[model samples]
Target: MSIPILSILVFLPLAGCLLLLPAWNCRRLARPIALVVALTELTLALWLYASWKGLAVNPFPQGFLLLEDAPWIPAFGIRYTLALDGISLLMIMLTAIVFCVGLAVSWDSIKERTSLFLSMMLVMEAGIMGVFLALDLALFYLFWEMMLIPMFFLIGIWGHGRRLYSTLKFFLFTMSGSLLMLLAIIALHLLYAQQTGVSSFQLQELLKVQLPLETQLWLYAAFFLAFAIKFPLFPLHTWLPDAHTDAPTAGSVILAGLLLKTGSYALIRFGYPLFPQAAQMMTPLFYSLALIGIFYASLVAFAQQDMKRLIAYSSIGHMGYVAIGIAAWQPVALSGAIIQMANHGVTTAALFCMVGMLDERAHTREIAAFGGLWGKLPLWSFFFLLFAVTAMGVPGLNNFVGEFLILAGTIKSSPLVAVLAFCGIVFPLIYMVRLVQEVVFQKERQPLSLNDLNPREIGILAILALLDIWMGIHPAPLLEMLHVPVQLLTGGTP
Candidate 1:
């Protein structure tokens, strides 16, 4: 029998993480090893993507690659089921890309305890992979928590001032919500046991779970609380700005790039199917929050001088489209959401990387200090402009396609939302254009004689730029990969 590719993907990182134990004395080798591991994972993910032509279609089963499953803890009826349908596959690809970017961004910059820092990043990749592939809810939660530990240490150990406070805040906030989800999961397990007299954690089995309306509503609320807090929708978003501001460059990159997306991913993957009826009932509430987040976060982003905080706020705004797409329930819309999530992962990671480069050189994130950079650091300005434009949902880029699908989908749901969300797009144009004007286009105001992108920086940004442009002109493959899972969720004719 062939070895399970998905299992290999998950364990390879843990293998890399474990290697740190014996070689703790040599800190210099750790970053290189981690970079190698990240590259290896990317190769594997690209292999998978190529197998599927990196395309997703409606009715997503055909797009899934390297699916594997088996029995584990059979007495309690649990299984180690894993699959890579469109959604999972995209996330896996995104994980690999961002992991590579994070490693490259941190190269030659992170000094203290370099070995331990890379170890945490390895663990983080492992955890995120598990979250994307695990088919069993019990297994999913384990992956979910697995991601938290490495992140805590990353923020707490390598983070800036108030690192401890920021890490704790991030931990407590997520924990508070996830705890409620745990209760809900237990409730689901017991209910399933009561209904079928089998204590199973199989996803296919649980899909058949029929519960009272009131019960579904309550359970949905519990799960939503967990996903929402992480999504940091509207009111619950307070933790994100602080966490991003204080976290090290790599921490901010991974946090913005992968950690927060898990919340939105859970909503699309589990929240809806687990409670479709409840989802239908709560559409209005979800839409309202999405709109508020889109407009409000943009305003907050506009007012920020701290580059990381501005990007962090923009993350919340971009995610508003994810929520909007989910609520829209149109096939076009769902595809948009998935694409946007991937686009956000790439573009935002690139932007945060720029922030890292800036902070590393200038010793501060204040935008005013950056002027007349176009000549002094033309390459850096070019890449930053590219990423900033993509983030603003510019035409002929990845974000534009997703944003269009979202608006087109939202119109079908609520024309008011379609109109309101467009307004949100304008907000980004204001700040993003201004970012270009002041930071790059303005006359040379400072003679600090900044440098352009180094080889590593250009390499990562090149990958991102290629993807952004690729998605803009040729998004068909992506749309194909995502079709089936979405159709499955909607129960609509494909």
Candidate 2:
């Protein structure tokens, strides 16, 4: 029998979380234990990457490359089913990478309740992993909500000023969405049971039950509301900046690097695929919101004085490209969207780390407080510049390729939207360039000592920077994993 790789990947972190509970007194062990588990997860993810050749010529009966199915609740058709495809695999890998970075960055920053902080992070990791891999709707919802508890604490307990306010806002917004999605899930399951005369919450089985356009519209709206709130698309994105500004560095990293991606991933994995007609009907609205998000977030980012908050807004803008790509619903655009998710995760996470490091040394995140850092912190300045420019979608960087492909694919669908998006790209460059000047190169506003990047900080940023360069130059491998799945979705070559 094949190894239950998916189960091991999902539950391993939870196992680590349990292990940490007993070590609450031995707080010193928390970091190493968390680091070991995170590293192990990353190793497993890389192993999968290395061994992956392509999808099988014959797809699995359940439509996943790797799947595990067992009855968990026979009466309700809820099952302990975990399934993985190319997209899930990518998400899992990204989760592993970002989580590893999160742990590394938190090594020294988290002082009080060390064991608890690490434990929450581990729990959240498991939840995210389950969300990516679970094929059972019930299981997926369980994991989706499971992630929230840890994040809520991460922001509320370990966070900074106004942490309680941000935490409350985050909870209210997310809970409202989760309840809607739960209703939709329950209704969808019942609908399936009524049609097939067998209750089931397996995504594959659910996909087989056809619904009228009206039903699809309602269900899709429920699902979309949940995702869009999480996606925090445009007008719904207000909570993100506050959350990022208040939460600890690790929280911000995971929030930007992985949590946000889940929203778009679900749209691709479950939302549009489950309700194709509704997705088509909603395309124009998504496109308009995406464009508006890109432009609006860029302007707000440009105006921000807090470095962390600025990067937080930049995340919303970068994600707008993903939304637009999904809205376009073409092969190339979808591929770009997926790639953009990973690239944005790496870049934005690194930018947050930079801000955190600066805050650690200087005790502030205000942009006006930093100036002429190039002379004082050359290493830090260089990395900050690289990631900032990458975020700007400069040519020969990670963001550039994704943005280019998105524009290329989007133009084929709607020339006017493409033109507007193309213009939106310039906004990032404008704000980012201005930010670089102010933070790294402009005249010193006050006399203060700032240190260069240390080995640990350098290592984190270096890994992310290499990824930005590597993905920008040779994105073929990522695009390869994406090709078959995206082809299935778009029915065209990616």
Candidate 3:
């Protein structure tokens, strides 16, 4: 039997967290240990990516490339099942990269309780990894909730300006949605057992049971509510700007980068595939919400005075495109959405890191507080402008590829949606260009002496910059991994 690389990838960080407990008093070792663990996870993810051969003869019917299954609670019909497919693989890669970046950003920013902070980060990484890999409904939810605890602490304890309020709001919004999803998962488990004369929460097994339209609609709504809250679409997105504004930079990075994508990922993995007819019935709702979110978020983002809040709102708008792609329900759109997830992860995380750098040096995130930085911080200004434009979906950049594919696929489904989405792109450029003009080019309001990006900061941003360029210029590799899974989801070749 082959080694269970998936299990190792998921639990290694948890083990690292455990390893940190003994070193709590050894404060100097905390960052180094966390860095090593994060790097290992990234290396493993890359190794997995390199070794992957398509699931040409997947033993599992769900089209997973690597799966590990073992009995965990047979009496309750739960099993320890972790599986990976192309979508999950991409997500894992994103998670690992973002975590490494998160730790790097936190190195100096999180000064108090460093050990505890690093431990929480590692635990969060473990939980996120599990969420991406788990194939059993019960196990998936376990990992789902596991990730939230550390995030709560990360924001509430280490954050600034009404951290408690933001943390509580985030917790309430997420937990409320989680409870609803739990109910849906239970309903499905029970429904499957009633028909099969046995209990199982395996996703592939659950997929075998044909749910009634009424039942599917209810279940899908429960799951959709859960995901949309995390996706934070439109009105459901009120908590996000608050959270981003208050949380520490690393916390914002994780929230924007990996956590948000899980919503869209779950929708694809569980929401639609489990309820085809219900999903079809809900397409109009998705499109309506997505379009509204795109316009609403972009407008609000443009109006924000806080740099972090501006970027936070932009996330909502970017995710709105993802929602539209999913709603289009075409193979190209679905692939684009997946690619968009990775793209947004890299770009937004980099943006947040940039914001953190400015905040670290200036002790403020207010857009008005910064001006004419180009002369003082040339390297920082260059990367900031690159990411800002990349976020705007400029030609020959990462965001453009995903947005273009989404629009292309959406046009085939609904020319009106495609047109509206195309128009929505302008709103972001409005904010982004203004940000560049204000922060990088405008004359200095007062003489300021902020040092430019240091070696560590330069290294971090440089890696992310290369990714943005490489992915934008040549997305064939990403698309290659996405093709089969997208084909399976759409039941057509992309």
Best by lDDT: 3
How far in Å is the alpha carbon of 487 misplaced in model 1? 1.7
Itemize residue pairs with steric clashes in candidate 2. none
Ranking by lDDT: 3, 2, 1
78-124 in candidate 3: lDDT tens per residue? 99999888889999999999999999988888879999999899999
Error of model 2, residue 190, in angstroms: 0.9
lDDT of candidates 1 onward, in order: 0.86, 0.91, 0.92
Residue by residue across 312-333, what tens digits does model 2's lDDT show?
9989999999999999999989
Query: For candidate 1, what is the TM-score?
Result: 0.96
Each model's backbone clash number: 13, 0, 0
Ranking of all predicted structures according to TM-score, beginning with the best and ending with the worst: 3, 2, 1
Better of 1 and 3 by TM-score: 3
CA error at residue 125 for candidate 3, angstroms = 0.6
List candidate 3 segments past 4 Å from native. 54-60
